[model samples]
Target: MSRIHSTHDDESIGSDSFLDVVSNIVGILIILVMVAGSRAKSYVREPGEAKSNIATAMDAEAAKADLRATRRTAQSLAGELDMLTREASTLANEVKAAEYARIQLGTFVATTEHELKKQRDELDDKTKRQHDLAARMVAARRKLDDLQREQISVVSTAAPEIVVKSYPSPISATVFTTEVHYRLLNKRLARVPFEELKDLLLDERRQLVWKLEDLPEVSGSVGPRDGFRLDYHFVRTVRGGSLTAAYYIPVESNLGEPFAEALAEGSQFRRAIERLDRQNTTITVWTYPDSFDEFRQLRKELYRLGFSVAGRPLDKDSRIGFSPGGSKSAAQ
Candidate 1:
């Protein structure tokens, strides 16, 4: 019995030992599993953190690039604005200068207009005075002519017993010889330089030939030589396809010497008469009604000098005129 009990006890001790070894192995496996799980979670968190850091750095770089571009754009705009401002200032200055120039021109024009008006006023005053003087002179001459006529009529009526001495005068005939012209008006005498005026008028007509092509009539005046001017009116007519020109010369009434000066010894009339040949030259007196007595005296003096005398009576308002178809002077 004792030997059998010893064998069973040994077997039970062996089984207990086996159970303890198995428990130890299981605990170790559980510890290993926990460690592996902790290591896996740490690895996953590290990878996610690395990805977030890389994305944040890229976003920061993009923001910096955008900021740099915005700064450059701002700088360019500032430069353009400065240039525009300077141009505006220059334009303003130019406008001011133009305005000043315009004002100066306006002032100058006003001054010129005022000066011209003043000169015109002075000229008008002078012309009015001259017209008044001319009217007075005409009135005095008419009164003198009336008085002389009255005196002649009274003498003729009162002197029936006195026998008047008369010279035998030839009948009047057309003057074909060289004629010297004289103006006997305003009780004054002046030599009419008809030849000199004719020459001057010829020159003027030559110069004005171009104007006659477009104008049917052209009027002009020659120079005032020896205080006498020749005013001429030229007419151009187209008849039967032929162009014909004719001119008329009108004498000015203001050209003559006073009676006292003309009758002087060294007068222009006496000198002109002394230079003329009595045989070839005839004295032509253009007489007005106001100066009939003066004309008679001049005619007697011309007859005494052995010169043929021609008398041309003109009306009060008549102007001495010459034309291509005018009648010749009749001399006695």
Candidate 2:
């Protein structure tokens, strides 16, 4: 029994040992397989990690580039805004200057127009008064001529009646050569205030005396026995009732009856009247047509009333006073 038991123990021990060896071998093989698999997995994981790193780098680079472009665009926009502000300021200044100039010009035009209107009114008023004075002068002159022709005997007979020694017609001084000239001097010079014109006519008396003696008749109505000579003048009435006088003549006789007096005195008186008629025309004015026309019309009336005229009635180039005359019948 001991021997069988001992054998059994040995066998058991041996079998156990053999099973341990096989187990060891299998464990080794398993360890080796696990290492290989782990190596393969590591390789695949390393490649994927490299790819992810590359993608992250590319994305970062694109973001940096976009940031740089945005910064540049912001700078460009700021520059454009500055330029626009400067242009707007310049335009604003120009508009202000133009507005100021327009206001100044408008004021000047208004002032000038006002002055023009005032001047026109003054001119019209002056012209009307001048026309009336001329008319009175023409009437007085006509009466003087009539007196001389109708009253030759009275002038001759009266000793100190201021008889004209001789007077000529077609004269620059017209009628009233010597004695008549003196009488007129007493009458007109007393009332006349224009000393310059009065003096000039009176001073030219020597020339008038010479002209009287030189003419064909050259006699006075009431004085020395030479036949009466005639001087010519043009006379007319104007629109403002003024008289106009000139020194040209285009006369024609319309008388059908013979003269009442064949005496030298009568002839002189008649000749003096002829001269008076001719001298009543020539007049002039420097104004508008309305004013000038008024002067012209009055002169025409004087001529029709036996006032003589020689030249053109009135000129558009003349100046006459705007004041009222001394005569009661004068235009005011």
Candidate 2 RMSD computed on C-alpha atoms after optimal superposition onto the true structure: 37.7
Residues 5-113 of candidate 1: C-alpha lDDT, one tens digit per residue: 4554565465556546555655654565455455445544544575775445554555456555555655565565556556555655655565565567667777998
Candidate 2 to truth, TM? 0.26
CA-only RMSD, every prediction = 35.8, 37.7
User: Per-residue alpha-carbon lDDT of model 2 for 1-332, expressed as tens digits?
Assistant: 34444655565566566556555655654564555456545544554575776545554555456555544544554465455456545644654555455556557667887888888888888887788788888999999998887699676775765754332233433322211110011011111122233344344443445554444323211111121112222122232122122111112222111222311244533444445433333212122333334334433443444443222222344322112222111110
| C-alpha positional error of residue 46 in candidate 2 after TM-score superposition, expressed in Å | 26
Question: How many pairs collide in each candidate, listed in order?
Answer: 0, 49
How much is 15 displaced in model 2, in angstroms?
A: 99
